[model samples]
Target: MTPARVTGTPGRTRVLIVGGGITGLAAAHRLRERLGPDAEIIVAEQAMRLGGKIHTVDFAGRPVETGAESLLAARPEAIGLAEAVGLGDAIVYPSDAKPALSLGGELLDFPAGHMMGIPGDPADVAAIANAKERPDNGLPILEPGADMSVGALVRSRLGDEVLDRLVAPMLGGVYAGDVDRLSVRAVMPQLAAALERHARLTDAVNEIKRPPSDGPRKPVFATVDGGLERLVTATSASARAEIRLGMTVRELRQTPYGWEVIAGPVPDPIKIKADAVILAVPASPAAVLLRAVEPQAAAALSGVAYASVALAAFAFDRVDLPERSGFLTPASEGKTVKAATFASKKWPHLGRRRQIVRVSMGRLGEEALLQYDDPTLAKTALRELGEHLGMRLPDPVEQRVDRWGGALPQYTPGHDARIAAAREALGVHRNIAIAGAAVDGVGIAACIASGQRAADTIAATVVAADR
Candidate 1:
């Protein structure tokens, strides 16, 4: 383990960032830009490696993302950060090949005109799921600031078919959460806000679907040409912070001057002081660290649960595949594989090389599946993928499995309010900030935005104190 560069020296204009994942890295980079070159910044990560869930592998003839495959391009924070980090030319969009859904053991096109599988018109999804709307009670769908479960909202507005077949499969591929436990406000904010204004779900869908202008629509998703890991490395280099790898930040203390962080091993601890500190780790560690300083915030965060998931990447020499990009499977199908992304077909760069397919496995309450050995997990992914593809496949040229135990935070109903209350509790602090996947929505863009906000807050405080 590398020794921490900065010691517990107070009043150094130094900023300590906990966790070396994308969130922490982004915060550090933005801090350097705001605080100028002389300000000291450090990134401490428990793991030897960085990038958090965003991992890229050198597979076949190109680099592939085994964790988060793409960024939500519509969000500016991620794209803007990538461009700032000199990955503008490397940004690539997915091919026009649309993904399919496996329903009743058959691949079918996703319902047209829908918001995460809730169709604008019932007729559009009649072929897949029967949309049964509730009787109009002479009132709007939901009151202002009210919240409900995604399943309760969908099942009440549409039916279980739409919830189970369309929404669950599509949303599950991203969140790895059960629709019944997920929040409507947090997961579908735009639509949820629309619901407050309109009486029908169809009207809410149309409102969200309204085009910004007559201009051409931009790509919904994107990735770097080399891989997402490039974004991580480039951003860290640009930040120029003191990188502390394999170091766990165990405690945080608010002193008369600023703040003190106890990091490194349990036996031999390192106390590092800074003008301000930002926490960018997961919910569990974040809660544990905050328990001493802010109990109310920590209690709220402690209750937040997480879902474990795994991915298996395979590179085949040659094989016939469908014209589609990939397929998504609903949990109702009772299959281990929830979704499969045909990387070669989806990305134009990889299309020229081997047929690369990444299969996503596990969901809430399925953590035991990840306990299996690598070979067993890979074989299970292969078998389930074959079942989805409806064909026997030859041996893959290369295969790798990556497990993310409790990688994804499960946002339950009223999650937004709880997190807001938590933030409100900590808002009294001048030199402390919180940012992570649990702080806001999960995605490269959301995390980046959260980190930048934290950076801006810390920068403002430092400037004010100096003035």
Candidate 2:
């Protein structure tokens, strides 16, 4: 966040954007294009720094992501934003190394031709899944517009082994959530759509997987060469908005002229008025701000829940690490560490100066794990990682642990309908919009697209009012 303040609030058109994460920053960047240079944009963030779930630290003389490591390269939003912000040259893709699953105290190859471990060909995953024989009863998996938990769908079609051994761990690694409660529609839209058209789960997954092509398959993930923080800072600079640090938006008031937000310290709050406002914070904070305005929207948003997670980064001088990129373990294994990434091996650009291993811990119901001290978390990560690799390892040259409490949104069933209802209720009011990972989808691309949509909505309304 920038410490500098604007000389004075603009008289022509002033827009206040709440939050300073990628979602909010993306909104401001698009708003600048929509409203032109005449409009004054103000970004109010509670934290002294931007990038909510995206952070990087200097460890072992190399920058590593303490939060999200890569962007969904297949999607254009994240990479598009990076290029728009002039960091196009820094985009790098992960190596072809595959990830393994720790099962039965052995490292097993991750199921292939699958969507989040839901294999298109049951035979391909039979080794890990051990799925019981189920007669395809000529029944379609899901009807159009219907929603269900991922676990229910997988369990019924593929069997308990697949759900517990493969799918659960695969989804948990990204969402920090249990498949039993996670919305299949929200997390795997492609598979959900395919389910509507196919009678078998295997057929549904087949539709979502890439078809055989003559050309080489492109990478699905990418990241900035140096660090992800550069993307955050660059987007903020590109927005050209007056960045305010350490200012919390207390209450939102709608005035006859426009909107007024009470922000800053409770004792001495500043009333910053704006022609329009964007509520782009997390679901909980966004709910608090919307309660006085639209309770229905608040009610819908309030229902959304979050999962906490911790990442422990270690740099070892020389130890026997596997040839694979990393490994993911299922919750059924009673493992404290859910996943580990061989950062240097995955992203070869990091080089072999020292082997960098990133381990992730905690799940949806394990918020207390984040309460543990950093040393404890790091120690547990190293111990579990060594056990998984079948080797007792030496001490790391350098190590760090980053705990992200309520970082990932656990989208329950009917998440789309809830968000749609919230947006519909908020639509009754003018000059107000909502965006973020909670309401939209999680991941860098989803948040960026969500913010862009909100900005476009508000910008169109603001412009129309002037006309």
Candidate 3:
């Protein structure tokens, strides 16, 4: 592993960014773009590569994202960043593949107008509504006061039959989190807001259906053309900042003049002096690193738990499955997969006939399924897909398992309080900052937003201190 170039004066105001992930890379790039000539910036990443959790592969004559597939179309940060980085032309639309729900080994069409089973219309609920079950199978807007788990919400809005048959497996496949433990408020606050305002979930949907004359705009999401890695690589090339890969920051200290970081080997660690620092690693590692700087903040950060996730991509010779682009399995139903994506069908670049499918397994507290080896994992995935597709498939010509011990963060109840406290704890210092997926959000766009915000903060602080 090559050490990061340690240049500049010992007491100079240089920004030291830890972690080479997208968030850290974005922070460094944004600092170079926004900061004045007087300020020096450097990024130190533990891995040899720059783009963390954003792996893209060119396989079967197409590009496939092994990590992050696409940004939420409704989120603006990713799109805006893409434009800023000169990647606007590469923007692609969300997956056009129709999502299906798998229930009791039976594939069922997802109910329309139902956003993650938070019913917005009585008519929509009627498709799966069970007359014998009161309020539970009733429409979202029809139920005045319903405070249930997403599982309960689904069962109530749809039916236990549908919940077991479809809804549970669908949601479980995505979050990998147990629906009961998962907080709808933290994960989907807009739906919660809709529920609060309309008294019935369906009423809020009805309101949203009508065109709004004027109001605070909603968020939008978009992805670049060559994949998100293009944004990362482009940002790295343009930053004008030094990047040190394969160098892990072992310790950080606040110096009388600025800040000091100890990185690389323990016997003789490389020392780096900087004006500011950004912790962009995963939540667990970031918490450990922040312990000495701010114990309380570390504790708060530690509280922001993460879930283990695994992804397996497979390619088949013939793609004849019905249009099941993406479907989820809710946690309540106790299914192996939380979700599956038909990559070939979802993206134009992936191509047809030669189908590339990506399947996600495990989430939050339920990760027992991830313990299987590659062959076992592949076989399990194939079996599940066969059951869902309603036919046996030819063995995949290409298959690989990507295991993420803690890929996704679970926003539990009181997440806001934990973050606020963590921020306040870090705020006690002058040249220390925290930015990553654990803070504001867990998506690619949110990570970029957090990094940019941290960069602005560091740039402002450095300029103010110089004055």
Candidate 4:
């Protein structure tokens, strides 16, 4: 069926942003800032609520995150946005707590000076390294602009023990991806850049880890006192956009004057016309929407894979746990649980309330685990937690299982090139832009930056057309 394009009234420009996730809402906020109150901005979210993966729920009479708990505060985008949305004072950093790795039935401190499990100092990871392994003679040569799987690169330089016991666990904690397929350039760009100049991987990592010649060090991570979702709520409330929940955007087509977004249910779909559009949904949905307008872009986006994972949050009345935050299980350990974060121990604010722990499960090729019922998944997490702590845990006072399907985008080898191709194809349409974790970085800060950049690009293109 041909999509109908409705025209906006004269002198007014309408911007329609699809997805209504953090990225989409950030775009809306940026649009309001750039275009002012006069410009019409609309955000369409298919889900009943906003924030996407940044979901928080009331547990044991206190708010807790079922999805992402903290924001990478090293980047200014998230902190800047928080301040803009009147949530500056509510920001809280995690308590000083060390993380450990679960290896060979023991919890050991994660090696120091490592980036995503890639050890900067070989001696630091002696606990996990093979005693029989000899010292590295030299790092393998990587051609300029070349890319390889993070696992392949690490294994080649550091050996199987480091790749399996160190790198995979760390990378899995973030991406829920297999190190053998994850891209070093996309996931660890700084290290990849440093590798081009240095011959040894450890030297490159050390260079990347070097402290900058600047002022006092800032907190690396932070979140709202109540919940990270507060940032989403505050941003949505501050944005001047008309947010429509349960509104699915089906397709996008260019119009003579602007762009037409075909959205809503099939039986009674609505065509909304806009001077510009931002596609901020996941890669799969975005691919379908862009297939009609930009096939090449869609093809590139289609190649982007995603990983699904589940979080099981448990609250206990009285339980004994270590002083450290949590422990991560390497894939080679063959554990059902990937990582466990002791919320009560990690956050002082929560520690004052009740003992709560969050267990994460699943990885890139572990979709079958997600098929299990919520109760079963929770039990799996509980069992794994007991095994890791080496104690028979009592029944939890409260428990919640939150499954996030396709929550993380896998930045495999050639990810940057694929994104570049899609952006080039999309450049032909000045009034349209794409932004989200799929094309850019995955962290909250990166998503915020991507959304703001897309908004800026669209605003500039529209202003140029008017001039």
Candidate 5:
């Protein structure tokens, strides 16, 4: 890869990328690979550091994931990227099957016969009753088999006992949002597919559960040995683009020849010019940046909203919680905490006897316990754990709090349509592109895929220029 250069000719296409998150970094790396020694690319980051929400911290000698913990099993994109960066040997899987749920105040094993949150037929499980079913009355748990929210779906199929008692809490731990609003299509499409095909979620789950034959098995969950930040560090080292830290792009405008960027007060704030631009920032910032260049695109970008979130990681004696690795709380119970993970139990290498526990609170736009002082938040989190786990510890050895103001875009029912319209409008522009988790799926894999595709688009356009 060659260093980026600025050329004044209209034909020489220089690329500018906004945002230093995973998507932006991945785009920069891909651009370097495809453009070889020709194109000039620059990346600008608002924050002091890179790797937006992919945060991992070391507390009391244990690795705690303050943000995203792992990538999905079926998705190859994240794992592939790790391999490309030579971190493949660091992949580690956790015990996902050990997860539990907290109801009213009791821990319940999640019902065994369902896919994601959706159940097969509520009638099939003898212990579980439909949400509409009456203890002794002549009514069913809910309106007969009506499509509903994940909360309602679990309630109707697994019974209010399972919905409030189990399912909701488990989901709360992962998504940190109102389960009712987190669409099955967006969060768990496989479970949704079961609902669409088998008419009962149980049948779909059962089909996937054939007894395991003797064969090689792969790990279901994975993370780098050094930690997830290694991926970011590696990408940054290999990127050919001119990456500048602490530079915030305030706005973007198009010129007859190419594009001009307005960045925060650098020596030459308005001098950065590019023939093409990739807006890899979150929807909130991307909306503001595209307004002048493409109003329709800006409107679409702004329409995609995000939820605020906070995470607290605590380290303690490993034997504190002897139960399962971790669990979630259901929304129906109206609890402040969304989920909790038992780190020492989940990852043995985190500690032998000293343990790490991570508690995540609040969804997009919700107030989190992290808003309080560190001691107050830590105490509050442990109290909830004691109540749910029926065990208590003196105090946490270490505590860390991380807050994301507008992260993780909520994909509502019409999300796909809005994104399609935004992309269509963007097509009118000659060298503008958009890439981020807001358009594609969330998680590390999705971000990498989005970034790589954006780079491909630029590479294709440049090839056409030569023709």
Candidate 6:
């Protein structure tokens, strides 16, 4: 595709951001904050609406999330952004409901004092423990600059029962990835760092889980009362950047003045010129856009893999569920549904007018289940829920299935290295950076931080050019 003619006016530092998800919107907001009204910022989203992978819809006459339901408030990015965008008062925490685990067709309480299913105290999981002894002495000394699979580390240090039943279910719920392929450093950095200092895996987990101070503890997770999608709307409004929907960026090339973004339909594509660019899309599209400008970066990004999962939201008229919030099924159980969340119970703001629950299905190498029609997929989720809860669910008020294809980024072993290589290759270019779940952590907090970092980098470049 030929480059579209440059329309950027002189004297103004034009910054073009691709993708209008939370990452892109966050970047735009940061850019506007740093550069003020002097900078011209534009965001192009291929989708018709904003908030990628964060969708909320009207169900049972109430706003229910079809995608990401909560934000990790432990990190300040998401909470800070929400407060900045005037959503602080709307923030709501989960109700007092503990999550359970589905084991041997029985719903059991998920053991506490564990870091990602790695129990600090073995007695907490005595019911499921198969290992004869807890490695109290600690694990082997982990050398500096060494990385291994989380599954391998847990299995060697703890046991297969711990890895399969506890760690796998918890981590799998977040990443939808296989523990054997997930990176210890990337997925569980704190534990990885602790391993270097302590010989035992349990000891490391215990140290990591220790409270830093006696300060008032914050909620583990939070979300806007209306929906997380409201954060997107508020951020986009605050950024005040020109948002172009249904605009697909095809290619990127460096120009003498700055950068040129070739986008729009193939038949009649448009070119956007900017002094800086923030690529905040997924790995596949980012790879395609960077191939022409930075081939090595493109290659590194291409190696990033993604996993798709489907959420089936069901609103029941009358159903009896345990007082607990939800349950997670280990892959070892050979279950189709990985996890289920009792939305109404977890989020009190969702209200008790209608019982709302979400069933999540799919994992790494489980794309076949996603091929089924929405109805069929919903049925599968309901069936699994029935078996796990030991009660037949009566479908009633509303039901919806939301499919997220190529959504969750898998951080395999050496994931950080690949990201570093991509960033290093792109360092040669001026005012060009990549941001999103692909590079940073996958949580909302991480994505916001990554976007802000990209914006800061480009803003600094613009200021340097002015000098």
Between candidates 1 and 5, the one scoring higher on TM-score is 1
What's each prediction's TM-score? 0.97, 0.97, 0.86, 0.96, 0.85, 0.96
lDDT of each: 0.89, 0.89, 0.72, 0.87, 0.70, 0.89
lDDT of 1 by residue, 215-280 (tens): 877989998988999999999999999999999999898989888888889767788888899999
Candidate 4 residue runs with Cα over 4 Å from true position: 1-9, 131-140, 212-217
Q: Per-residue lDDT for 31-140 in model 6, tens only?
A: 99999987899999999999997888898887898888899988899999999999999999998898899999999988778899998877778887664334455444
lDDT of 2 by residue, 75-107 (tens): 899999999999999999988888999987899
lDDT of 1: 0.89
lDDT, model 2: 0.89
lDDT of 5 by residue, 1-467 (tens): 23223434455567899988889888988888888767777888888888888866777875567788776655787888777777778777765447666766776666655555444445433343243332322332223222346755555444666565445555655555565566655566555555555544455556554345589556666777656788888887777677778888886888886678878565545456887789889888898998887888899878776776666787775454755778776655565567787876776555557777777777655654446776676666767767777776667777777776667777654455567788889888877889988777677788889998998898788667667
Q: How many clashes in each structure? A: 0, 0, 31, 0, 16, 3
Backbone clash total for model 1 is: 0
Q: Count clashing residue pairs in model 3.
A: 31
Give the least accurate 10-residue stretch of model 6, judged by summed lDDT: 132-141
Taking all chains together, the TM-score of candidate 4 against the true structure is 0.96
Overall local distance difference test of candidate 4: 0.87
